[model samples]
Target: MSNLSKLESQSIFLLREAYRTFRRIGMPWSMGKDSNVLLWLAQKAFCGRIPFPVLHIDTTYEFPEMLEFRAWAQKHYGLQLIVKINEEAIARGVGYETHDPVTVTHELKTVALQQALAEYQWDALITGIRRDEDPTRAKERYFSPRSSEGEWNYKDQPPEFWNQFALPPKGAGGHVRVQPLLDWTEYDVWLYIRREKIPIPPLYFARNGKRFRSIGCRPITHPVPSTASTVDEIIAELYSTRTPERAGRAQDHHERNAMQKLRAKGFL
Candidate 1:
């Protein structure tokens, strides 16, 4: 089998395993290329009907195109979307405009997600985070567990060898962060999107010689110079490009340990 096919099979297996093992499961959709691929794989894994709700933690700072695509994809796929927002933070005027990137991210994304998980009582969250996306993420396991307070102890993570994954002990009283796409790279994601004819937000494609390689809130995410306007062109670009995928993310530049702190605090 082709490598991409093998990857797809493994992701499907992980998705199924998470669903079968957890009492309640949800998939967090960021409306980015990777999340879109994960969503597609979830539908395929469940015979064109995803069983869990798709969560979107809207910080009210996302790019307009992202919000539009979120609405479009929801209708197009008939998704069970649950949009969560930390209205309390917004009311307190916590945003990029007033606070630093890290504070805004923590307040809007991390806190909002915690609220959603508490409100929904999800035992497992199917996330689209890939190890190749960030160095902090490279330490993740396929069935990574978080504390009851939603903190990830990366240094004490369980081992996964061969195709065996170690689940958290029974009655561990914590949520599992199932990363089905943990092994996929940026190039693999683009290739899968092309192969599956998946619909992604147009922001990924270059416009005026600039395109967002990794999308986030518009205030902090910048575009890189590129001429790759189509999926095929993007695939070709990935073959020769030396740019770090998240170079456009301003939060990474804030400090060396920024992402590690965020992930430890459950900022996926």
Candidate 2:
């Protein structure tokens, strides 16, 4: 089998395992390229129908294109989308400008996600985080466990050699964080997107020699210099590019430990 095919097979396996093992399972959709591919795979896993609710945590700071694509995709795929807004935090102006992006991320993303999970009572959250996207995310496992209150212990993870995952012990009440795309890389995602014909937001394409390699809130994310306007071109660019995927992300530059701090606090 080809490498992308193997990656798809493993992701499908992880998605099924998470659903069968946990009573209530959920998947968070960031509406980015990787997460969108994850959503497509989830539907394919269930025979063209996804069984779990898809999550979209709207901080009201997302790029307009992201919100538009999300809305369209939800209807196009007939997704069971559950949206949660951090209205209070946004209202208080806790954005990339008014405060540390880390603080903004915590208040708007981490805290809001915990509240929604508590209300929904979901035991596991399927995330589309690939290790190659960020150095901090490289520590994640296929079946990483979090505290009952949504705290992630990234520092102490279980051994998972040979596809064996050590699940959390009983009485360690908490939600399980499942990462099906943990092994896929940035180029793998683009390849899969091209193969599957999955629709992604147009912001990823370059416009006048600038394109967003990693998309986030418009204000917090800057586009890199790129002439790659199509998926094929983007793939070719990545083949020789030495730049990190998240280089355009402002938060990563603001602090070295920014992504890890967000993950430890449950920012998916």
Choose the strongest candidate by TM-score: 1
lDDT value for model 1: 0.92
- For 114-214, candidate 2 gives per-residue lDDT tens digits of 88888898889999998888878999988888888798888888889998866765235588888999999999999999999999999999999899998
How many clashes show up in model 2?
0
Instruction: Give per-candidate clash totals.
Output: 0, 0
RMSD of 2: 1.3
- TM-scores of the models, in the order given: 0.98, 0.96
Clashing pairs in 1: none
lDDT of each: 0.92, 0.88
TM-score attained by model 2: 0.96
lDDT of 1 by residue, 1-268 (tens): 9999999999999999988899899899999999999999999999998899999999998899999999999999899999999999999999998999998999999999989888999889999999998899999999998987888999998889896988875335579999999999999999999999999999999999999999998899999999999999999999999999999999888987999999999999
Local distance difference test, candidate 2: 0.88
Error of 2 at 244 (Å): 0.8
